[model samples]
Target: MVNSITGLISNIQRYSLHDGPGIRTTVFMMGCPLRCAWCSNPEALSIEKQLMIFDQKCTLCGECLIVEPEAISLDGGLRVDRALIKDIESLAHCCPYDVFEIIGNEMTVDELVDECMKDEPFYRNSGGGVTFCGGDPIVQADFLVEVTKSLKNRGIHVTLDTSGGLPWDQWDKLASAVDLILYDLKLHDEKRHIEYTQAGNSLIFENLDHLAKLGKEIIVRMILVPGVSDDPKDIELRCKRLRQSKANVSLIELLPYHTLGKGKYTRLGMPYPLGRNNEKDKVNVEEIIQIIESIGFKVYYRSP
Candidate 1:
């Protein structure tokens, strides 16, 4: 008998030019518990598997036929006719620019290692490996444990991109599993945090404190979303906390709010969270950067 390494995977982003360190494979896991208004990957939010069809990207090739007849014609353009999905999946395997995609699938740890191993040479030469990004990897504690363990044993560096809003015990279990952490700090005030991201900052701040105390190599991130999250006061609040913490703070990336996920809302039958926010002044980035840097923290315009 053999013990298998199984993990929940929503998307396999190979050759991701941007993330951290170097060229890496980004494994987006499903099921995030955060409702951040500026979330970019809403499709990766649910724990359940879903078929994401981009009408703009689709060629109307009539592919993706499910075994059940009722599963067809999700938006009148999939055109998945009599062709069996087995063949269609193989035929349109990762179509150019992702015409259609099945978000989230369960795979074993061994299977995940096998998949990531394809970039072993790149990892070795560039000092890059797997980055566990998800709705939030911390949400799937056990699977994250198994996957990171396997990757580490195989000499792969693992980075956890999180919101730092997990159970303290879970954080304790996951602390040593990965090589680095990319934690997100959205809003400052507890009330504002809940109103914007729908999560309390108490746990997030607690996790941040614990990570700092553990001497974890952490990179703090703040998404600068125009007038809302990019306000001078909000920026100063998070920056002050970072400076006061034991963690080595770096430059925060001001990811100017964009409508990247606008279409996803309609596809998911949900409304886009884009609300009233002032047009981000182009000078805001420099202003925010200067403020953070003035505190003696090496602040940058992008991800630390």
Candidate 2:
């Protein structure tokens, strides 16, 4: 019998080629420890259920106003006091125009496994399987372990995409369960990392060193944000650290920053952290690739 372990899920993206090997069904679990300034999926940041207003779809029917007058107002346009809303879930149903949407959904272990199993044929044909990602999957480690175990029992290949911000014990068990680990290396300096992500790199680095020594397959993902993380020296420091740790790294994937998820902040009634001013900020791909390759690591980059 499958246990009734439930986890908060943000989205289950199907047919994704960028996450891991082959075509994958990336299960994005809710909640994260790091707040990357250039995060694309802002909805996945919070552990709690958040309301997203689609102002374009809203007919201004005034139905949602009846549910929470203080929270919902139509003074000039659709104005939502997100913090003031207590019954956030109720607003999702109250909107006849389907304007309001709740970001997170609860899924039991069995249900999630069943959902992933739907794409088993694709997984087998394309050498792909389910990948557990998140705001950072480590936030829901316990619940995901059961889900991963259930999937593995069904003969599915599993991958974990994480920032490695949590402690060792949390990653140890899950690392043993998954086949591939997509580890993120955001910033080399601990103070800058704290300033940007609101967390230190000490625990993350320690966990990476430990994971590497365990001989686990790891693909270090580095997101290049022009002003934030695009420094050559910092990148070199990260590569040197990985080399020093003797990490079992298959390759290093360079992810470029984009304004794709900026609109999500507006929907969630939150300010876009990096703002639109940096939209034109570009990264020197050739320079970054040269640096990583010179360090004796294979590189993977998809042109945007």
Candidate 3:
């Protein structure tokens, strides 16, 4: 019956170095509750299968138009009315060239477990295991719980990368199942948090507090978006909150923002929320690191 539990996933990246402790496999689960302005994995944000068109690969073939004439057009080039398209998979299949790609895949718990187990030897040798990330793995908490349980029974380490945006009750079972948590602390101000991520931080902070009380090992990851999340005052305040909560924060990781995902938005035929000029110089990395270290927490940052 465990084989019948299916989850939508965007990708399963293997041999990841930065996701967790050792060489690990990172499962990019599909779907998220938050719509952060600087989201890099736009394809994983939605829980449904989405059509990703690579305009460059298109050869102006009218085959796709024949499949869904109303949703596709070859006027000057390739044009897709994504909202009007049905049978996305069929439309993608109609393309002779891989100009069309599907973003998500449905995977059963047993299938996912087998895929992770393929790297079990590497996990054992490197102290690395499977790290569940996404649009936020908590979005598919039930499926994750079963998968993690199967993996745990096999002695594999599991990590949950999350924004903690959902209510505790929604993902408490999932939180208990993972060996470690890679928690994201994006913005502290509730109003500003909602403005940037389209989600409130109250529940996120509450869940962090709960994780702390449960003695869950947490590594706080903060993406240092230049004009948005780089405010020293906000960073300091966030650290103060983390310190006050006595969250078992292993360390703080400062991730610099990049425009790598901008192209993804284009492929999905969706406007990148952050404009083309959104890439600004990151705040002084040393200063940001010092700020976190000053609060009695170790810091890790990889320059972009």
The ten-residue window of minimal lDDT in model 2 covers: 273-282
When 1 and 2 are scored with TM-score, the better candidate is 2
| Residue-level error in angstroms, candidate 1, position 187 | 0.9
TM-score ranking from best candidate downward = 3, 2, 1
Q: Residue 156 CA error for candidate 3 (Å)? A: 0.5
Q: Give the Å shift of residue 185 in candidate 1.
A: 0.6
Q: Give a tens-digit lDDT track for model 2, residues 1-304.
A: 8678899999999999988899899999999999988888889998988788899997778998899899888987888887788798888899888898998999999999999999999999999999999899989999888989989998899999999999989768888888999999999999899988889999998998889878999999998888889898899999999999898999999987778888999898888887545656778888889999999999988666
Kindly give the number of clashing pairs for every candidate: 8, 0, 0
**Candidate that scores best on lDDT:** 3
lDDT digits (tens) for residues 8-45 of candidate 1 = 78788888755677879999988777888878788778
Please tell me which model should have the higher lDDT, number 1 or number 2: 2
TM-score, model 1 to reference: 0.82
TM-score per candidate, chains pooled: 0.82, 0.97, 0.97
Collision pairs in model 1: 5-108, 5-109, 6-108, 6-109, 10-104, 251-299, 251-300, 253-302
Better of 1 and 3 by lDDT: 3
List the candidate numbers ranked by lDDT, top first.
Answer: 3, 2, 1
Runs in model 3 lying further than 4 Å from the true structure: none
Error of 2 at 170 (Å): 1.9
